[model samples]
Target chain A: MDPLSLLRGLLDTTEDAARALVGRERIRLAVTGLSRAGKTVFLTSLIANLIAAGRGARTLPALSDATGGRIRRVFVVPAGTETVPRFDPEAHLGALAADPPRWPERTEDFSTLSIAIDVERRTSLGGLLPERRLTLDLIDYPGEWLLDLPMLRQDYATWSGETLARFRRGVRAAAAAEFLAFLDALPADAPAEDALAKRGYTLYRDALRACRDAHGLRFLQPGRFLNPGPRGEAPLLWFFPLPEGARGGLADLCARRYAAYLDDQRSTFLDPYFSRFHRQVVLVDVLGALHAGEEAFRDTGDALAAVASIISGANWLERLLGAAPTRVAFAATKADHVPTRARDALAALVEHIAFGARGRAAQSGAAVSCHAVAAVRCTEDAVARLEGQAVAAVRGVLLQDGRGATIYPGEVPMKPPEPDFWDAGLFTMPEFRPPRLDPAGTSGMPHLGLDALLAWLIGDLL
Target chain B: MSGRPTPRVILDEGTAPAPRLDFGWEVQVAPPVPPARGWSTMALIGLGAAVLVLGFSLLEAGNFVAAQFAQAAWLGWLTLAVATAGFGLVFVAIGRELRGYLALGTVDRARAAVARGDPAALRSALAAWQAGLPEGRAKPGDLGNMPINAACALVEAKTLAPIAQDAAALGRAAAVQAFAVTAVSPSPALDALVFGWRGIRLVRQVAALHGFRPGIAGTVSLLRRVAVDAATVAATDVAVDAAVRGLLSSRLAEHVAGEAAAGAVAARRMMLLARAADEACRVLPR
Candidate 1:
């Protein structure tokens, strides 16, 4: 470690920092969604289409300048990182290209995939200027995990009170009845013990599961409680919301554990990873929530509002470190579930549901856009005749029974469904299997609105 | 699903319905994939044939001049004067072909400057483009208000869009003319002659509209550069489409309808070439 060498090392670090401040070389795109909101499929399709674009077939038409000729080449290259596993698009693509063509497996942990886009920027000094390299560092994390970052703001008592209050309200009461009975039996000031903590954690988790799995709720929070990462259950996770009492025993113990949990997350997840996002995409399953009836729909709307604010209002730490996402895209995923004509209504519905949040995010200087996207088009538009008249419908291989079916899923309502809308119950939707794909991956997948999303995300750079 | 705020389902008061934001360019417009197709033997053959014809016509004129010299003196003098004028006219035509190259070069250099983003180049390109505007046009849509850089960036949208659009219209018209003449003409030779003339005429008109006046030879050169891909399409895919249409129409109508499909196939190629020519002439935002 000579003094000259050390100084040179410092200078090298300085140049790298300077480049990172303004260089458009490596851009991190953070993508997350709710549970089963199609996060894995979206990332996989995005990578596959880009790779195909390299070989002459590109479905990304909105990126006119890039796909038309400006892009010299595009390919998914393995990212070199030690912290997280390299994202394997091949495995996901293989699953979708399976004989029966199934959806890819859900994201279990964070992964990184790098796409190298060699762009010929003719705008500044056409042929004489060198080609620019843009590496799209795509960060894919479990949709169930991102929502937990927002939880760090609240302490154990505030969170406990809110959870208890939710349990006492509307449809949650019935879903959490067994949990509520268990809560009523335990005294808040009971002595701290491993068995008691485990019992409470199990009961509260079951309640969240019932609300989500059985009742089709969207926003069950402390998302780690639902999908507890690769480590499964650490000791700190064995805490649950409790009724108010003297703050001396069990309540104090749980509060300490909650603080420890937040500290662990802040070091391992927030600062190093989430804070580095240059752009963010929040995917919402609005159609699935709509199918769950009014209660679930409203619940989803609340979750989106919270997310919008969080996206726009990055904590002071993230902002100070220049990690606030400059642009945020709210995507209504699985758009192939609806007919093409009604796709607009589907976007409008989501917009109206979260209008306030979107406007605020935009005001806060994050370029916000809403889009209806189908990563892999699972259905084809068809005219289904009912009573000797034609109606808009989608025909696909239904996931329910591995058979082809045409379903007129009804007009996606322009605004939120009217009061008593559930009485008709006609807006129910079913999922579909992935479309067949080329085994060798030469042809790009047919998609809806992904080009628009990509264009908004990085069209200027191209 | 519980403890959510009471949902307020209401549209905006008196606000218009929001515009559709699902703009996927793939569905709205199919981008032109003009693959670089090198000059085929047919193109070379056409050029060679054209050169031979021109050579023979000049030789015939030479022979007439020689014949006049052997006739009566006054009649020979009159014949000599007419032949000399014809030779001068051919030279003048060649000069216009040179002018054609010059005019095309002016825009090409300015276009390169714009791409380079040189401030001086931007200003020069602006002046050159402004000078080329059609008479009585009201400043070509806000170019007068824009800064030089801004002007060049949106040169296509503000200045060249209308020109490109009109060029497209002309392309379509030429295509229709080709289709009509091909369908009605009794001979395949007539169809070929008419299509070639129409394509040449379109190239000249489109180039002239962008401020270049090329002679027949120059027009053909420009045509070759722009029409390479279209010619390939006509040779390959368009023929397939025409064949499909021909088969479908054969069951529906008699003799003439079958040729109409082939006519349409030729028209499709002409339209594609016209589009390429339009793009080839545009000045900025490359």
Candidate 2:
């Protein structure tokens, strides 16, 4: 065996033995989703509700320990890794606590927050077991960054060809027209020049931003181009894909930089985070995508599948050690936007989108599940008269105008949308402002199915 | 009648027209021009043919042209070279110019829509302008500022007052905390520290209303920049108040003032700067 594998084996054994001795284990939960998927709100509300539950407050009843009165205490603790920044729960919580409560900001970088939950356990023999402490470390990172994991296995030429091909189709083609023209104008065999490279990078970055912000496309690659980290604009990020059959100093330079980015992504970001995570929640704004259009919905599916592949493709060393068998959850967020009657169909749609990825994960000895949840419920279900018939709808204050309005958003299909669905008009998914909440309320944020999501995610561990 | 001498209205000679009171909004109408076609390509081909003909005639009459047989060979080669170069350049130039023209045309349309000052049209125009840029080189205009836009929209929609009230209550609580800390510790450093911490929290809360989250480093950088920006734009208290009013909605000024009142001079300036930076950074694309 290789020396590194041997070292990993030793570490796994040590960790397993330590858990067995103490009857306690640490669970690293990674929370990631594409932009506007309610990740920051989820983390903030999850922490608040958990803390509230431990304080004997009425929150998260579906969490067995909390409902059973078995949760003794839960409090935030210093994270295990000093190198990673601690998640600023106070900043997020404070934002939500403001008089006219508002949603927290979106996730930009990876942050960790560890909470120690002391729970009372019962033994198999029906005897009361000693109180156990489970440390749950939550990791929050931009879903955009997670989309770049697949690039680790692809070379510059392959990525460029694939990405450019995608850009040449449908809405992306129009959005990327200028950048594509710039690419066409460049000489394939020309010598590499920094001025030309910078121009290409800037134009490409702009195209990706426009696609994301304006068109709601989710499959933009090299995610850093959109969600640049602290050093996002450094020289390493100055590479753009060259056209196919490209050869010469320019192509060689781009290829080298692409390799360097992949290396940095692995060693600096992905490897460290993936190696430690025992559970992951892949948040998908399914309704938002469906509302965006057929093209966006399909792109979101592709993005989710890519995320699933990365999770299940653990290294051989990890497999052999039987350590951290990650359980993946594909959650369709903003279930409140859908009426109560349609949530199951929404979940079915989520399952359909993640069908291929879930199957792959299960085959790899990893558990996978799909759910539709609203981390913070912003609307209430109602029956509204539409076209002289009673239609199930949702009533909420519009985020844009803050005026109460009733929306009969179209029905969610139970299966993956077919080509025929695209021919029909897109569904209207209005943005709803968060409902007013007293900061001192027992429930941090009114949500639907969040308790069930929590129970499914960490119930067995507790 | 009560005053000893009633003030008589005096109009200067140049101001006698009283500004003409032109309330009629007039949009400029420009006659449409036909799109440029193959004129450029045709011109290039003509130039290339002239060059080809002139070159051959010169070669035929020059001292170096020893034989008439060589002239025919030179002319054939010269025509082929000129034709290929001329046509290639024309096609390439037209392709490029057309692409640029389309992109710029979209931006021009958006700018015209913005000039109309309709909110819905403005939003659409902004989206188009953002999408139409060659390199996303266009920065958000003054009206495109997110915080200012959101605040104005919320006020027009009757949503700002409630949010402002909540912010004011929160700000008051923060001010109370700052005062408590200052009263207990009598140290200027401790006072500055407390005020800075509260100021960051306040800014984060305000930014959340507009759906902006600047991380810790971003927030600090913004605070520093805001101070510099405020100093450059506002020299008096009235100017500072006006700047703050524009940045945060006017209704929220009370909250900012409360926070500023509880801190030292340096801390107050920092708070003011933080508020300015929060509004300025709102225009940045996430």
Using TM-score, give the best candidate's number: 1
Q: Would you list the clashing residue pairs of candidate 1?
A: A125-B116
Residue-level lDDT tens digits of model 2 in B79-102 = 656655766776676555455334
Interface RMSD of each: 17.5, 31.5
The deviation in Å at residue A135 for candidate 1 is: 1.4
What's the CA error at residue A114 for candidate 1, in Å? 1.6
lDDT of each: 0.70, 0.66
lDDT of 2 by residue, A357-436 (tens): 67766766778888999887777777776445677877776555445666766668899876656555555466656665
TM-score: model 2 vs. ground truth: 0.60
lDDT of 2 at B169: 56
State every prediction's TM-score relative to the real structure: 0.61, 0.60
* DockQ of all candidate complexes: 0.01, 0.00
- Model 1 chain A poorest 10 in a row by lDDT: A121-130
Whole-model alpha-carbon lDDT for candidate 1: 0.70
